[model samples]
Target: MSETTEEATLGLIADIPPGFIHAFVASLSVIVVSELGDKTFFIAAIMAMKHSRLTVFAGAISALGLMTVLSALFGYVATYIPKIYTTYIAALLFFIFGLKMICDGCTMSEDEGEEEFNEVQDTLKRTDEDADVESQTADPAEVQKRSKILNVVRRITFALFSRVFIQSFTMTFLAEWGDRSQLATVILAAAEDVVGVCLGGVLGHALCTGLAVLGGRIVAQKISVRTVTIIGGFVFLIFAMTTLIFE
Candidate 1:
């Protein structure tokens, strides 16, 4: 038993090289590039259009942070386990995420989401037009005051926040469960500096999610869901094949 424990400890130390900065840069670059056209990019952008941007960012960043931690922990454990176990598990994760992305892309209706966004925008426009017509008899300052109050209330409600937060969190959390960037983070941490990998991963995800939430609505319209999914799927499949080949 002592011999087995010592061997595992030795395995853990054997893989970690002495370059924290190298791990940080490697992880940051890998994740940012890996997630550029990822499914989560569209999800964050589209959801921002329908929900509060702050809340969506909150939920998304929160989910990503948690997922990063989970990956780092898994990678840390992988260092202590047999190499074969890590290889097979990582390969399985890649295959599952890739296949699922392909399936989802084939079945998903991009038009449905687009139509819903259109409906929301149209409703807001009509409401504003009606309000303008109705406000001719009303005091302009009072109307402005009321609008500000309504906005404040909308932003402050716990019920509204909890619902949107949960929706965004659930969507992001599920989307990245076995995602390519996530899988890469896992592998990177196992062989590199764990702290650097964790920090780099969280920052990378934040950058991706932030851009998607802030600027995604316009880009989302320009790109097709199927294209993003297929691209992400192929990337994962390619990465999986490479991992196996190299092994």
Candidate 2:
């Protein structure tokens, strides 16, 4: 291992007796298994079809990283609180999200959903443009000159980066709230080294979301958004049941 890995491992080992390797491997395996066919994976894929791949991946991974940190912290703190309450909360959230997704999938027509999505994108674009305009100086000539320059920059930056990043971040973050993978992270943290669990959990999520983004690009052309949403909804429902039974 590299020096950084060595230090991380040593740090984790200091707190937990199983050592870093064990904790890392176990956390990675569990999370990988738990996240497969999860809703967040589908969300990443769907977003990739609609937005820049890199930006979507960045946002999704960023959200997962945040979730991992929260999970680790919660797991560490879980030592003091009763774990059953956490489990119940996760279960309830999973069920509610699953139902909401299912309803959205079943109610929204493809054309309607596409229109709504486009509307949101357009709104965001306009909002960015408005903000750029508002930032201009008082002189009309300077304002016109700067506006022209900024419009080009903003178009490139916003179309390719900010819009996708914000969408992916918001979608993934909300979808991941009370997700089973996060709950699994918490459970693993309670049993293993916190640093190792967090690292491995993040890695597992990265791999899953990355694959989804890639796969989305190919499959989005073939499948309808409504169909994907319905499938994702069912997956979430299954996740809820599984979490209730196992976790």
Candidate 3:
């Protein structure tokens, strides 16, 4: 039994691919840094303000994980092209990303991402009110006469989780469809190990999403948006250079 177990463990370790660690680390570091102050990050934070943390967390992480996997798949497809060309493409993409982020950072409004959160907040508030109104019975006396404990239990178990999860998932998925971080994942997956990139991106998204849900708004407020963007911009540029250099 011991010998069989040892063989199984060795087989598992041997099945692991090369370059996974490097790609995982690279993808993780880049995504975590870039996702700070992102719109989707704010979306998570804003939704958490009014919704259940677990619901929001589940929705946000799921959406991001889906996007990351899709991006990595696209990147893997691009790998069919010449390796040299793929490297150049990834470097070029990162360079363009760096420039774009820098320019946006330079010209960003003081309230760069705040408006999105406020809009989401107001819209969700209205939506929640509408939902409540729609769900109301014509006779409140009948509703009150029903078992209040059972009603509370039903709301907690069924109504609230579904509503918040759907909203959080829809909002986050839509917000992140074409975001920089998603694009970056695509580029990295194209040039690196796709599985590594996908795993790393998911981990990074989870971390960032968790932070947003927990209380990232406080840290966001403490730092200047402009500073974070510029820093991220520079980080992208450095990555671009390193991609080319290392390739």
lDDT per residue, candidate 2, 29-126, as tens digits?
Answer: 65665554456766777677767888899999999999999988887886565656655664565567567767877996765434544554465568
TM-score of each: 0.54, 0.52, 0.76
Candidate 3 residue-wise lDDT at 34: 78
Model 2's TM-score against the true structure: 0.52
By lDDT, the better pick of 2 and 3 is 3
Model 1, 111-160: lDDT tens digits are: 53355446545654575588778878788899899889887776676546
lDDT of 3 by residue, 1-247 (tens): 7999999999998887756776787688778877877778888898888778888999899899999999999899998998889889898988898888889889987776565456666776797799789668447766676657578787776655596787788888998898889889999988888888999999999998998899866856665677778878887888788777667
Error of 2 at 134 (Å): 22
Winner by TM-score between candidate 3 and candidate 2: 3
Q: What's the lDDT for residue 151 in model 3? A: 81
Q: What RMSD does each model have against the real structure?
A: 11.5, 8.8, 6.6
| Residue pairs that clash (backbone atoms under 3 angstroms), model 1 | none
Once fitted onto the true fold, the runs of candidate 3 whose alpha carbons sit more than 4 angstroms away are 1-18, 110-116, 126-161
Q: Relative to the true structure, how large is the alpha-carbon lDDT of every model?
A: 0.73, 0.70, 0.82
- Which residue runs does candidate 2 get wrong by more than 4 Å? 1-17, 80-161, 217-247
Task: Return the lDDT, model 1, position 17.
Answer: 58
